[model samples]
Target chain A: MEVLAHGLGGRTDLPLDAVAAIVGGGAAVAASFLALTVAWRRPRLRPEGGRPVPARIARALDSPALTWAGRTVALAAAVFVVVVALAGPGGEKANLAPWALYVTFWVGLVPASVLLGPVWRRVNPLRTLHDGLCRITRADPAGRWPIPKRLGYWPAAAWLTGFVWLELVAPHRSDPRLVGVLIIAYGAVNLALARVCGRDWFTRGDGFEAYSNLLARMCPVGRRGDGTLVLRTPLTGLMRVTGEPGLVAAACVLIGSTGFDGITRTTYWRDNVDPGSLSAGTLGLAAAIGVVTVLYLAGMRVSAALTGEAAGELPGRFAATLLPIALGYTVAHYFSFFVLEGQMTFILASDPFGTGLNLLGSTGHRIDYDLAGPTLTAQVQVNAIVLGHIAATIAAHDLALRTQPAHRTVRGQLPIAVVMVALTCAGLFALLSG
Target chain B: MRGVRLRTVVMAVAIGVAVTLAGCGEPAAPSGGTGGSGGTSGTGTAKSAPATFTGPSRKPDVTVVSATVSRGKVEIAQNGVNAQGRVKVRRGATVRITVTTDEADEFHLHGYDRTLKLSPGRPGTLDVVADKTGVFEAELHHSGARVFELQVS
Candidate 1:
């Protein structure tokens, strides 16, 4: 009955009655599917159509001065984190590097991107540095050779998988020096790739950039290809996601990583899985990803066969539907971790070097656990998971209508809808059973 | 208007489901309240309740239980027989755990927040009184490998 330490939020006694949460989640998704099938006939989300933002507001947001300022701030913060990580005390208590990477940057990026629309792309320090180096050398930043079109987002997917493995499976992930070294290594590799691939490399190659850009598609406020700031429905923005190469793999990685995170904390995993073997943990992580991929691909195949569409085209066609589900799992798994340990970033910012100098006067601040008690945490987790499933169902239904003939739409989506329900149940079980 | 109505219906359904789920679980109660007191009563009376000790001792004089934790297994001796399970101690009992691991790790006892650094082949010992009656996780800090649960009751 030992409450295992899963993530940043210590000992989460989520007061969710497992049966009720799972049942409610499954029912909610099923109800949403029925509602969509009955009421929704045409594809409502139009990616190309949006109301233009006011001239004054759009001008300010797109200003060169604002972009430079954001880049400067991001670069300065990156430098500060590196300094502290290298020079500061190594433990989680004294070091801010781990908290910054895991809780703040990794988890915080989700809400930030969803609200602000690809904030990381605008403020990415590595991109700025690469551009600066290109300027100094009087050379093209996009490198002499072009990145092949077929490469697509595969590199981003691979790198994302590697990053998650480091976070969830690596033995010394919490060590500040190790985190710092990884950050430096990641930046070096990406910057070198950026020089050859040009600035477009970040759009599809950088893992964090790809992650931010994908989430940003759901943001209501987004700039069109012509740099016109427009306000659209969130679903409209989500419709803009293209099914590029490895998009399915990327989505599965997101879903499966979160799945592993939840399952690893359960009594079932603890009692059954070998704790001391790295191979066991790796297998568990891979199996979770494999299960999600297989289930999603199977659903898409059934839908494709019914609709008379190519099976190869179905993955990317239905990839956008997974975003909400991924976002849901991210929110459910990291909500408390972000709220509680996110504060540590600010506290550690005050004393980055673990020296007594209180730079930000936040060194003495304590995290308020009452902000998310067990009851409130459980409610949010359940609601977020269920709502996410509902959103996914709607997104999939809309896509199915747009892709398939009107006569085949409902029948084609039936299997996928069932898959969504099952995934919702699995998600709820992970959150509650843990 | 149709979109708005559909959104409203979805919202209503979500709220209804949330309410139903919330109603299924009991409200959160203070940790170690009646449960801890009851467990103390069930166990034999304390021979001597130390005046200064109201909580788990930072340092305690106790029998050191030797355990070996590898990548996936926790090996401990029980009654001269090797067994794999959580460490159990009575409430108010002073307890010490000496652990050896195949890899370097920061050994952490969660509820107590006591930490020990264990290196490969090198054993580390942690001592604390079982002042609280509850199940607490003991794990490797970075790797997140659970060594065992310390069930004190």
Candidate 2:
């Protein structure tokens, strides 16, 4: 049981009981079937109209002054973090860099994007740095060559995989020096690439940006097709997720790795597998992610055969629906950790340099574990999984209305339905089983 | 709407399944009620305010497991040999983790962050109340040797 505490391996929520997991998976499947049967035949979620905010309000929110100020603040924070990471105290306890990256930025990005809609893009320090350098050199911020259309989100998927590997498989992942080096390296590579690839590089290239943008698609607040800022149901935002190339890979990477993380938490995994073995970790991660991809592709193939749609197109066609499932897995796996250790992010932020000087007087409290009870945590986990399944089903059903012929819609969705159910069960079982 | 009717049907079937399955095992709801003084333990109540820890009146039900570390090798034995696995128990059970190390090491229980300092040729005991639920690792913090995991549900 030599399970090295994964970075921020603080507190894990208690596993769900068999009954809850079963009931959840059962209810999820049942509701999804019912939804598919009763859902509207026509494509209901149009990309056009939502409750549009006033133009003046939208302008104020997206104003240059606000953007510049936010970017400047973000740049300053980035500079401060780099300084602390390079020069501050070394240990996990004293150093603030690891917590800032893993806890605040990595884990915190989920809720932030879900709530605030692509908040990172607005405040990405790397983007700001590129813009500043470009301005200083009197160069165009958008670089010379436009990013190729065929390369949709593939780089994002690759970089996201790299990051997931770093988080879950890489040795010394918790080391402050490693974190600093990673940050610097990631920045330098992306900044240099951004210089040549134009501003669209970050949209489809920067892994963090892609992840933020992916999650933000489910946010209620977003711009419509005409660039009108509108408030709508979160599911409607999900409807807007295009089945572009590599979208499936990105979603699979997110959810599959989360499932792998869940597996690592299990006593069975810890006992049988070498906990600290990098090869084992990498193999398990790849296998988990591969299982998801294989299942999805297989489901799509079945659905395509039944519906007479191209198999290649179906994976992309239905990729948007996976977002909810991805969100579900994320919420189930990391919700407790974020709620509990997320406190450390803010606390450490106050004394960023490992110095006694507290910029914000917020380091007075410790992580309140009892804030999230085991029962509530279990409920959230199961409910999130169930709800995510339901949402994905509905989205698939609706998208099916658009993609598949009217006669073939139900038949085509049957396979995807099974896929959703299987994925949901796999997720629930991962939560419950040791 | 057909959806409305299906929803009702689904709920009824779910209830039926739940009732049928309840006979097989304990209800999957939170059932641990061994709260010492935290009186809000009817169903894992939201513990916000710091309650005074009044140690229980009844004798603590203790589950003891011991480990021996010698020359970078760990041998965990509960009662016999080669039985090192997750020590699982219901919430509120007391677990006394005993460890004897050939070298100086500190056993750190994660999640609870409880620590027990151990020296050579001396066995150290750390008593932990399984108040919180989760899988927590007991590791030699310095050596990063994870001895065992405690699973409290």
Candidate 2 stretches greater than 4 Å from native: A1-6, A240-242, A362-365, B1-59, B70-84, B89-93
Name every residue pair that clashes in candidate 1: A142-A198, A275-B71, A275-B72, A276-B71, A276-B72, A277-B71, A277-B72
Native-referenced Cα lDDT, model 1: 0.73
TM-score of each: 0.80, 0.87
Q: For residues A169-212, what per-residue lDDT tens digits would candidate 1 score against the true structure?
A: 77666778988888999999998988887988988899999999
CAPRI-style quality class for the chain A–B interface of candidate 2: incorrect
Among these predictions, the greatest TM-score belongs to 2
* DockQ of each candidate, alpha-carbon based: 0.07, 0.15
- Second chain TM-score, each model: 0.56, 0.60
